[model samples]
Target: MQKGKIGVSSDNLFPIIKKFLYSDHEIFLREIVSNAVDATQKLKTLASVGEYKGELGDLTIRVSIDKKKKTLTVSDAGVGMTSEEIDKYINQIAFSGANEFVEKYKNDAQAIIGHFGLGFYSSFMVSKKVEVITRSYKDEAEGVKWECDGSPEFELTNVKKERRGTDIIMYIDDDNKEFLEDYRVEELLKKYCKFLPVEIAFGKKKEWKEDKQVDTDEDNIINDTKPAWTKAPADLKDEDYLKFYKQLYPMADDPLFNIHLNVDYPFNLTGILYFPKLKKNIEVQKNKIQLYSNQVFVTDSVEGVVPEFLTLLHGVIDSPDIPLNVSRSYLQSDSNVKKISSHITKKVADRLNEIFKNDRKQFEEKWDDLKIFIEYGMITEEKFYERAEKFVLLKNTEGKYFTLEEYKNIIKDNQTDKDKQLVYLYATDVDAQFTFIEAAKNKGYDVLQMDGQLDSHFINHLESKLKDSRFVRVDGDVVEKLIPKDEKQEMKLSEGDRLDLTPVFHGQLPQRGKANFLVTFEAMSENDSPVLITQNEFMRRMKDMAEMQGGMSFYGDMPDNYNLVINANHPLVMRINEDKEKDLEKDLKGMKSKISTLDKRRAELEKAKEGKKDEEVPSAEKEELHDVSNKLDELKKKKETLLNEYGQKNKLVKQLIDLALLSNNMLKGEDLNKFVKRSIELI
Candidate 1:
């Protein structure tokens, strides 16, 4: 036996490894297993080059846990390290000092490890002591035993003969004895090594012998050596990709479609990206796409490697070029990673385009499920937007799908406003906006369903991208005003009469938040709803955006403002106007005369005091002006109360307010119940 100190400038190497180098202690299994896979791959490369003459039989790596012995072992039959090789690779710690190393990589622990090749050292994180028993493939080499506690000292000695492979035995520390359990080790292996290139065995296969599970001699492999992504597209059927997806996410609904990513020119990247059926609020399940380095699992939090939008996809992405690191930003900014990202985006867009061109009906069938991803891509990636324009689908409330050009063509003649801007009408809720949708359909217009989580931001993006086009919510205005033709009708009511009618209708409406409603009149076809509640497109869109995104939180904090648009052509509004003209015309005129006199007196007092100091202004004149203003305001109130009384007796005013409230799906709780009862009585 021989003993030597580890080649390190500082004795603090083991402490750093245990506390700071790796993010999680459980990753030790992944690191050891990854090292085993690398050794196996190296042997395969040598055999391919005709350097190894031995049989390459059963290249699976085996993991076994001995609970009684408190030992966890990872054994691999591959190219093993000889004594000299072990001295160079394992004994030497590569860093100047712990502080300097940490300062250089404080923000990104993974970058330091990935760049400097620290895979083997991670084993020390979980083990109190570790032993490597191995025999090199060289003919004259004997098996060697290397032992090291969590320190800078290690031992190397000759051992009994063994196969040309390595077995890493980790004596689980007292604090981390959970690793000695078979289930714990098995779970870690499955999570990190499920899609590795080499088969990984956890234990012997179990069979239901005599109605009880009993372990067999055959190895129970945990990984698929040849996942669907590794196979050629020509060789893979659609069902095969879906089967693999189901294996990855057993509880999820079937994926809409998949993009097989295989590129070599710019950067080596191979993976299958599945478009999941994303409906309603888009909950970002981070780390859904596993990033692998040469088929060994590195991480699932591949935010930097994959485009932010493509993170919604689920599958495996194996690339030797994408270095595994905790700081995804560093990985993303790497030249090879950037190239790979661009290539993946192009490949995704191309796949969608191909599907649309070849089998449009099928593509349309999956559009609802695929819209969220496509819209997110277009919203985030400029190049992706450029390519996806042709294939991105617009789904209408009629359960039909169309490309941008197709939908624009369908609605151009009927829905274009007087300014020649093409109006693309949309509805967020089919049930809630049913009235608006029916109103649009009544005018021979189509309403697309822009209801996805990203649709708010996406519509804004499309408005900027599409020329002379605007997306208007179906409830944005009365159908006639929504796509305004070239005509304006004059309001026939006097100013006094308009003032009288304002409070009558405003008094009956329910108040919510700081809601402000402007009572306006529009001449429309009598068949349209007598009252329509509409919001400005910009404000509504901003508010919708605020619901999904931050930075515009000010818009979200504001109350919803609506227009209580009363149709003048409808009989109910016409009768209300006629009643106002009859009941309050004289009183409103008298009040207006008094108000004008009071305003003149008050203006003169203010005008007289313009250049004068407070002492110079007469108190009598100020008191007289205040008295006049108070009398004038009282007279105006009397006039308003008379009109409000008249309106209260008129059920048409209450009916209109209720109708508008009901249309917005805002009349709820007891108010909704009252509205339903009132509606039945009115009908």
Candidate 2:
């Protein structure tokens, strides 16, 4: 027997391994099982190279838990290490400067184990004592046993004869006795080894006999030696890929399509990415893409491996080039990882373009489901945007689809405004904005349906991409103002008439929740609506963007601003104008005469004081100027009050305002009831 301490520079190595080597103590099982698999694969390689004449029998790895004894063992039929090989590989940890190593790698335990050959020592994280029994494949070799008790010291000695393989036995500690549970061990195996290259058996198969589960004679294998990602793409059918997708995500809706990625050039990468039917809540569907290294599951949180937008996809990505235990910093700086990400983005764009060009009908059928993902990618990744622009679609209110260039060409001749800027009118909801949509259609203009989750951000993105273009919601303004032509029409009402009618319209505006309206005039045909409700395009867009992104809360806190545009050419507005002139003509004319005399006196007083300093100006002149301004303000207020009183009594004024409000889906309850009763009385 030979006993000695592990060749490490620090006595704190065991404690560090236990406390900080791995983020989760459960990963010890993965490390140990992976080591067993490495040994088995090495033996196969040697046998194929004519280096060993041994029989390559079943290389199944077995995991067994003994609850009573508190021991969990992983046994494998593969190349075993001899005494000399064990001294070089297991006993000596090759790192120097123990203090610096601990300081640099304290927060990264898994990275330490993977970088420095410390796989076997990971068992110390959850075990009080670990033992290894092995027999090399060499002829006339004897079995050896090695044991350690959570300390630097270890014992190595000769043991009884055994097959050419290895066995790792771990005595679970008091705090980690859960490792000794059958269900716990089985769960760990399923998580880390479900798709491993080697067959792994947890226990005997179970059967339901007399309403209770009982062990059967057959061994229960917990891993599949070959998963769908490991095979050639040509061998798989669409149904096969779909079946594998169902296996990965049992409760999810069927994926729209898939991309089979197989690249061996600069780096080896193989995986299948499925486009899941994503919902509006993007955060809920993240972390669904599992990452694997040589068929061994590594992580499901692959934000670092793939582009941020690509994480919305679901499936598996297996690459032998990526290290089994990679650190966050390493992932960010690795060239291979960057290449892999770029390649994946390119592949996805290529597949989408292929489908779009070959079968556009099917593509349009799936656009409603695919729009959010495509728009998200366009907003996040610049390279993806460049490739995706060719296939990204623009769906119109008529349910017809067109690409960016195609739609631009179709509308370039008619939709270009006076300033040469192309206007792309869109509706968020067809039913809610039906009036506005019909108005646009009546003018021989096309309106797009931009109602997806990411359409707000996507519209902004397209504006930046498509030069000399801007997107406006159909309800953002009146049809004439949305794409104003070079021609202009004179207003029918004079400035004084407009000023007198402003308060009349303002008094009839509804008191909706958090919404403010500004009375304005637009000269349109008599056939148009009497009153139109429109929001400013830029302000509305800012509010919508504020809801989708952070750092723009200021816009969200502001009240909704709408424009109450009264058509000057409409018969109802003309009647209101005529009625106000006829009823308030005497009062308004007298008030205007008084206001004019006060204004003339104030103007003369201000002109006399303009050229003189305060001391030179007479005190009487300043006092007279102040009195005249106050009198003028009072007269104007009186005139406005009279107009408002007359407006409140005019049922036509209230009816027009209510009609506009109802069309905008803003009039409710009492106001709607009042409008209905008023309509019946008018009829």
- Candidate 1 similarity to native, TM-score: 0.88
What would the per-residue lDDT of candidate 1 be over residues 341-440, giving only the tens digit for each residue?
Answer: 7888888889899999999999988887788788888999999999998999888998988888888889999988999999999999999999999999
Worst 10 residues of 1 by lDDT: 323-332
lDDT of 2 by residue, 240-270 (tens): 9999998788998999999999999988999
The candidate that wins on TM-score is 2
Provide the clashing-pair count of each candidate structure. Answer: 0, 1
Q: Indicate which candidate wins on lDDT.
A: 2
Structural similarity to truth (TM-score) of each candidate: 0.88, 0.94
Model 2 misplaced regions, further than 4 Å: 97-117, 324-332, 596-627
- Report lDDT per candidate: 0.82, 0.86
For model 2, state the Cα shift of residue 523 in Å: 0.7
Clashing pairs in 2: 21-109
